[model samples]
Target: MVSAWVVTKVAYVVISIAAGLIFFYVTSPLVKSEKKQPLEESVSLLINFVLYIWVGKILLNIDVFITDPLAILAYPSDSDAFYAATLLLFGNVIYKVKWKGLNIGTIMSSLAPVFLGSAFVYEFIEVVMNDSTLAWGHLGLLFLLLLFFLIFHERQSSVATAGGIFTAWSLGQLILTFYLPYTTLYGYMMTRWFLVLVFILSMTNLIQNKRLRS
Candidate 1:
C-alpha cells in the first residue's frame, strides 16, 4: 500500500511530465513528422533514466531492501543516487549513439524543451503549493532559459541550440548555488562540482558542433 506522500510525489511527477510534453508540442519549431522520432526517442530515454534512478536508489539502500523491500518504495532518493543514475544514463546514451546510430544532437534537441517545461512546472508547484521560497530562484532561471531558447532555437541548428540551452542552464545553476542555500535538480541537491562538469561538457559539445559546421 502506497502512502499518501508517495502518491502525491507520483502525481507531481506525472503532472510535470504531461505539462512538458504539451509545452514541447506547442512550442517546438519542427514540423509534425520531423518531431515524431525525436519525441519518441526522448520519452523512451527518459523512462530508462527514471528506471536507472530507481535502481540506483535500491542499490544505495540495499540493507533496507533486504530487511523490508516494500519500505524501499517510501525511501527518498538522495543526490548520490541521482549522480550515479546520471552516469548510467550517460553511458546508455553513449552506447546508443555508438552502436545504434542515434544522433546525440537530435536527442538533446528534443530533450531541451521538455526538460525546461518540466523543471519550470515542478519549481512553480514547489513555490506555490509547497510555499518554498527557495524554489523561486530556480523558477526564475528556468523562465530565462525558456525565453532564450525560444528566441534562438529557430535561428540555429538543433545541436547548437541544445548545446546553448544546456550551457546556459548549467552556468545559471552554478551561479545560483552561491546565492541560494543549495541548488537542486528535480528536488535532489546538485553539487557545484557536478555543475562545473556539466558546464564544461556542454561547452565542449557546443564548440565541437561549431567546428564541424566550420
Candidate 2:
C-alpha cells in the first residue's frame, strides 16, 4: 500500500494538471496573448498558471506556523531566523529596502503550519530542509514560479511587484530549511498544498459566475 506521503504527492500532480486546464479554460483571453509572446514566454505563462496553485499552498503553510506560539518557543533556533534572513535577502534583491526591523515580521509570517499542524514524522519536519531532494525540489519550484511570474505580466511595474512577492516567499522557504525541524516543515508544506487546492476551487467558481453572467 502507498504511504500517505506518496499518495498526497501523486494526488498533487493530478490536481496541478487539473488546475492548469482550468486556468487555461478561464483565461482563454491569454490564448491570443500567447501568440503575441515569444515561444519561451508563452510556454512559461502556461506553466505558471499551474504553478500559482502550488504557491498559494506555500502561503497557507506560512499561516499555520504563525498561529502557534509554543512551537516558536520550543524550537527556537533558525527557522524563523532563516525566514528573517531570507526576507532581507529578498528585500535586497528586489526593493533595496534593508531595515533590520522587518525580520521579526518575516518570522511571524512564516510560522503558520509549524504551529497549527500536529503531525510529526520520524523526526522534525523542518529537518528535511537538510535533505538534498527536498531542498532541490523547493529551489526548482521557486525558480520556475518566479520565472513564470516575470513572464506573465504585461508591464514592468507588474513584473516588479511580482518580483518582490516571489522573493519574500522564496525567503520563507529558505528559513524553513535552515531552522525548523522535520515535523514543522512537513506541516508547512501540507498547509501550502491545501491552500493551493482551495485557491484553484475559488478560481473555478469565479469562472462559473462570469459564464452565468454572460
Candidate 3:
C-alpha cells in the first residue's frame, strides 16, 4: 500500500512537469524568434537550481542517504535543501555575470514571466495538497500582482520590469508567510530573505548601469 505521502510526492512531480511544459509552450515563440541563447541559458540555470536542491537534500541526509541513496529522491524534500540550492544558484549567477560576461538583468527578465507561471502552478498544487486556504489566497493575489506589473510596466527596460516583479513577489510572499500560524520554517524564511537581497542588488545594478550610460 502506497502511503498518502508517496501519492502526494508523485502528484508534485506531475504538477511540476506540467508547469514546465506550460512555460515552454508559452515561450516557444520567443525561443524561436528572439534571444534564443539567452532564453536557453536562463532555462539551464533553472534546471541547475533544481538539481542543486536535490543534490543538497541527499548530502544533508547522507546518513540515511548512504543506506538507501534513492530514498532521498523519493521522500519529501526539506527546507535545508532549498537554502543550499538558493545559495548555489546565487553563486552560479554571480559567476556567470562577472566572470562569464552574462547580462544578468536581461536574462532574469526574460525568464521572469516563466518563473511566475511555474510559481503559480506549484503553489496551486500546494494549496490542493495541503488544503490551505491561506496558501491559495496568497497565490491568487500574487498572480494578480505579477500580471499587473508585467502589463503596466511593459514599456520599461527588461531589467527594471523584472526587478520590479521580482521584488513585488518576494515582498508579497514575506507578508503572506507572516500571516501563517507556523513561521518557524528556517529554509523558507531564508529563501524569502535571499530574494529580498537579490531584489536590492538588482536595483542597485540597474541604477549603476543607468549612471554609466548617462
Candidate 4:
C-alpha cells in the first residue's frame, strides 16, 4: 500500500510532467521554423537540473541516501541543494553556448514561450489545489500577455519578443511586490533581480535589432 505522502509527491511530479508536456505542445510551432522541438531541449535541461539537485542532495546526506536510496525520493531535500542546482544549471547553459557555439538566442527564444506557459499552468494548478488567490491577478495576467505576444508576433525577432515578455513580467512583479498583499522579503528581492535581468535582456535585444537593421 502506498502512503498518503508518497501518493501526494507522485501526484505533484505527475502534474509537473504533464504541465511541461502541454507547454511543449503548445509552443511547438515557434520552434518548428527552425526544425527544432524546444520542449525536447527543455526536457534535456530539466534532466540535468534534476540530476544536479539529486546529486547535491545525496552528497549533502550521503549516509542517508546510501542507506535508503529508494526512500530518499519521498521527501524534500535541503534548500541549499535547490539553489546550488539552479546556479549550476545557468553555468551549464552558458558553458554550452559560449564554448560549444550552441545557438543561445534561438534556444532562449524557443524556451521563452514554454517557460511562461508552463509557469502559468503550474501556478494555476497550485492556486486551485491550495485554494489560494494570491497570484491570479498580476502574475497571471503577465503570463497571459507573454503567451499572447509569443503566439502572435511572429515577425519580431525572437530576442525582442523574449525581452518584451521579460519586461512585462518584471513590471508585473514590481507592481505585485509593491501593491499586493501576502508579500514576502524573498519575493521582493527576487523581483528586483528579475528586473535587472529584464534590463540586460532589453539592452541585448536592442543591440541585436540594431545590428540587423545595419
lDDT scores of the candidates, listed in order: 0.88, 0.36, 0.65, 0.62
Candidate 2 whole-model C-alpha lDDT, 0 to 1: 0.36
Model 2 Cα lDDT, one tens digit per residue, 1-214: 2344544543444443344343333432335554233223323333442344334334435565568743433342233343433344434423422453332222221221111111122122223533544444444444444455435434423323333333444444444445534212322342344334434543453455446546
- Cα displacement (angstroms), candidate 2, residue 187, comes to 10
* lDDT for each residue of candidate 3 in 1-214, tens digit (9 for 90 to 100): 2356756655665565457445644644344656567567767887788788888898899999999976777776667887788788889988988999988765676666666666677667767767756566457755786666547554666666666666666666566666665222211333556656766875676677567657
Best by TM-score: 1
Q: Which residue runs of candidate 3 sit more than 4 Å off their true CA positions?
A: 1-31, 128-130, 182-199, 202-214
Reference-based TM-score of each model: 0.95, 0.26, 0.77, 0.69
Candidate 4 Cα errors over 4 Å, as ranges: 1-10, 13-17, 30-37, 55-81, 181-191, 194-214
Kindly list the per-residue Cα lDDT of model 1 for residues 38-142, writing each as its tens digit.
Answer: 889878887887888889989998998989988887766679988989999999999999999998988888888889999899889888889988999999999
Q: Rank the candidates by lDDT, best first.
A: 1, 3, 4, 2
Q: What TM-score does model 3 achieve against the real structure?
A: 0.77
Q: Give the winner by lDDT: 1 or 4.
A: 1
Residue pairs clashing in model 4 are none
Cα error, residue 128 of model 1, in Å, equals 1.0
Estimate candidate 4's alpha-carbon lDDT, on a 0 to 1 scale.
0.62
lDDT of 4 by residue, 44-156 (tens): 77678768877777777778878997666555645666656767787888887899776666666665665566556555665667654674764466567765765665777
